[model samples]
Target: MRKYIIILISVIIIAFGGFYMKHQYDKKEAELQYFNQAKEKMENYLHENYKNIKEINFSDSYSINPMGGISVEGYLNGNKAKEFYGIYDKSNDEIGVSSVDAEEKSE
Candidate 1:
């Protein structure tokens, strides 16, 4: 009985581990796809518009929980990549799209 239990437990562990890994892979794949699309759009917009192209805005991090009263999907503006975005409000932090701090560009 002990041997049988050990085998069963091992099988369960392997199954759960595979499921978790697959879940993680799917999540990462989705994020990568979203970033690719967003980057293309931003590049197109900058190339076509933004005459002089001083800066651009992108979203860095975001979340929306209606039940928790939490919302964060702010904006970012910058002339180059690796921008540092900070704000007074907590609900204003993005990663991929709104990572530009538009205010800084005006100056």
Candidate 2:
């Protein structure tokens, strides 16, 4: 009886471990997709507001906050320009640019 209980407990533990790992994999995939969408939106915004966008640069790090907000740093034509911050709605895969400022930093 004791051996049977131990085996059952082990099986339960393994099942939970598998579930947790799958959850993490799904989360990371979703985050990557969201990042790509955010980057694309930034590029579109830059093209509309600035000329010669080929020279633009952007910081490597983009913060996605717990509240689904995205903050990105970008330079226009090789010089520091407005920063972007907004919320990403997963239901629509859209980023809403809340504000663009020249000196804003990620929190």
TM-score of 1: 0.51
The sequence of per-residue lDDT tens digits that candidate 1 reaches over residues 1-107 is 99999999999999999999999999877755555454545545343433354444555553323422222222324445434332222233222223332333231
Q: Which ten residues in a row have the lowest lDDT in candidate 2?
A: 98-107
Tens digits of lDDT, candidate 2, 8-107: 9999999999999999999988877777777777766655654445554666677777767666556555556544444555456555655544333333
Top TM-score prediction, candidate number = 2
Task: Compute the lDDT of residue 83 as modeled in candidate 2.
Answer: 49
Best by lDDT: 2
Which residue runs of candidate 2 sit more than 4 Å off their true CA positions? 55-60, 74-107
Off by more than 4 A, model 1: 52-107
* TM-score, one value per model: 0.51, 0.65
